[model samples]
Target chain A: MIDFAFFLEIIPVLLAGLPLTLLLTTASMVIGFFLALLLALAQQGNRRIVIWPIRAFVAVFRGTPLLVQIFLIYYGLGQFRPSLQAIGIWWLFREPYWCAIVALSLNEAAYGSEILRGAIKAVPRGLTEAATASGMSKLLTLRLIVLPLALRNAIPNYTNEIILMVKGTSLASIITLMEITGIAQGLISQTYRAVEVFVAAGAIYLALNFAIISALNALETRLTPYRVRA
Target chain B: MTNIMHILGFQQGGWGAALLAASSVTLALSVLGFILGAALGATAAAGRLSPRRVPAWLAHVYGTVFRGVPDLLTIYLLYYGGSIALTQIGTLFGSDGFVGLPTFATGVLAIGIISGAYQGEVYRGAYQAVDRGQFEACKALGLSRYQSLRLVIVPQLMRHALPGLGNVWQLVLKDSALISVIGLVELMRQAQIGAGSTREPFIFYVAAAALYFVIAVVTASVFRFSEARAWRGMVHA
Candidate 1:
């Protein structure tokens, strides 16, 4: 009673959700990268006032689950429509797409910042001193020496985070976005073939992650030529 | 004020008790899932390390596929496929019926499957961290493979693996929230019920987040304590 034909049929329907999934992953990751840089930079500062709040923010975001954050943004904030409308920013929260992107980007930013911080901290202090001795300004030294090394160190972990974001977007289905998991759920109820439909959906995710992982692997190899065997 | 009192009350029309009870259930689900995952993980670690080809390949496939796929889909698959598999198994035993598993069992099954993939990597890495010279010493001492593993390998492997396991534990706790979609009355599901009933999604969701945070912090303290114990009597441990 196993149906290969049904598996074949659901592939196209699930792929329909792929664009939104990719869009959400790409958009949130891009936004998340900038926010994370801000966060990482903020935490690197000396001011206690600046440090404590950002520390708390990162801890709160990281400590809780992404599902909770999504619900808070979507349903919880949806409860405060009048207040938001009065504040003139209700339009952003009005759409589920925007809500998911906001929640996901926030969550990704928290983790991405941690990764960025670790990679930056791992850079050798002597390298910076040498660059300074060579008469480079702090900004030029940071651009030429520090970030490139940190980014190279960060590629693998950031790639892992992106894969995680791809998986995380599936939760957007709970809030009524018709992404892969969402469409898969619809098909399961309609077709009564849960196993096959989910298999197809899972395969789609696996393929997406594989493509991303391979691309990152190529980039990692390019960045760290010495680490590779000839 | 009355509505807040009613919501916070332990008596009739209140959800404080329900939410707290569900939090305990959430803890139980995570522990059970983690234990089940540890068992599967141990088997997978052995399989991957085995000299045989098939078990190694099978374990590799299991780890990759489970880790690569989204966990929510795994839960959904188990929820639906479990009953189907159970029903068919029951029919061969002359019972024509729906052998439905409780939601908690299904949730554990999903978490176990997902966490097993991760824990296998942790165990394999820990095993590799054990000095190769130590294993040769055991062989030179004429110790049986089982005795060497029990005496020399397992303890150090566990010590090395403690931090990684701590991470997997946190992952399990958060992943348990995903089980709520299957109608399990865990913290997230309880919050959903309250939010839906009260139309105050903010309070319930925030309350849920708080509870999750408290549990995570407390559990982390326990892990830290255990790690400290595991590292005792070392030069820099």
Candidate 2:
């Protein structure tokens, strides 16, 4: 039997973890977006040094599972504690929160860079030429004209990546962060009511994703008035 | 490099065999789930394309709910809730005992359900791309509904759907790593156990990651080869 009262009771308990989930998603996304921009731009250059390493990094991240990446960063990197300690950033890797964030950010960077690179490539050559004809430097053209247009084009795919990261934050629970899924796992152990508790937890995620989807749609519509149906 | 080989070696104390076995589990999980998903996806696609209002709306809801949610959460729900639902269904047949789904079955079902949503979209798109004239031609031939779909629509849909389905296969393969949470002895979980006992997290995880890469790259090429064959002689269309 479905228990409405029990579902209602767990909603507050689960919502307590909502902040951590939101924090993980937002922090990683903001950091990841900037890193993605760097990675995307690095490949546009003629130098193999920058492009090869970034390309390799993106491929490794995209090719493997995120869970493996998390383990590699969280547990595997911890094995090199002495070297990490020597580098003076061991303190960051020592904490599960930072490890989770780093893993998530790196994964996002991989996917986002590709999305951005595609968007940048898809930008019309004439637009960049027009920018150059207006007497702007290459850097100035990229900054003023190219990057903005690529960003607008990248929004839909980037929105998907963001939604993926939001779902991805649930992995943080595995490293002992009590995010929504982690909290649900805990509640199931305590109450022995897996179905009811998970149903409630799923509803919260459904609501969260619904908000994201609607916001992204609105932004997509607002930015692309040209896409409006006749 | 010698040290790396020692860690990855298959002899007594090495993780190579365990890692390989786990890779098979991962492959089987992905393939079986994809098969089930393809079937479900076809159904959902049909529902969405149906003229009937309810089935179309339900299919839309199915796609929205599965696609919008995190796959990790979906797997967890199925892992825990599926067994209970099974037990309840058992009760109607006078069975009183708890009916449980093994971790593998549960994982497969979860992957199937999640991938089905994406597959549905791919099928629907492919269905849309099937020339409208093809359907009319089928009707003109006095073909039955089922025969029309079989004789005319499906072959073209398969051609268009191959790439999208390939993408979904990669996703499901990566997502299979999540089944580790429920203690399935798939590659990721095996890596976790090997790493924990060996205290060589770097070696085991790196090995696991390498295996995943090999599987992904190889399978992707397979998809590409098949896709090429599928598109052969159809370029002008």
lDDT of 2 by residue, A34-53 (tens): 99999999899889988889
Candidate 1 per-residue lDDT over residues B175-223, each given as its tens digit: 9999998889999999999999899888889889999999999999988
Worst 10 residues of 1 chain A by lDDT: A185-194
How many clashes does the backbone of model 2 have? Answer: 0
TM-score of each: 0.95, 0.94
Error of 2 at B199 (Å): 0.4
Cα lDDT tens digits for candidate 1, A38-150: 88877776899998887888888888888999999999999899999999989989999999999999998999999999998999999999999999998898889989999
DockQ of 2: 0.72
Best by DockQ: 1
Query: Per-residue lDDT tens digits of candidate 2, residues B184-214?
Result: 9999999999898879899889989999999
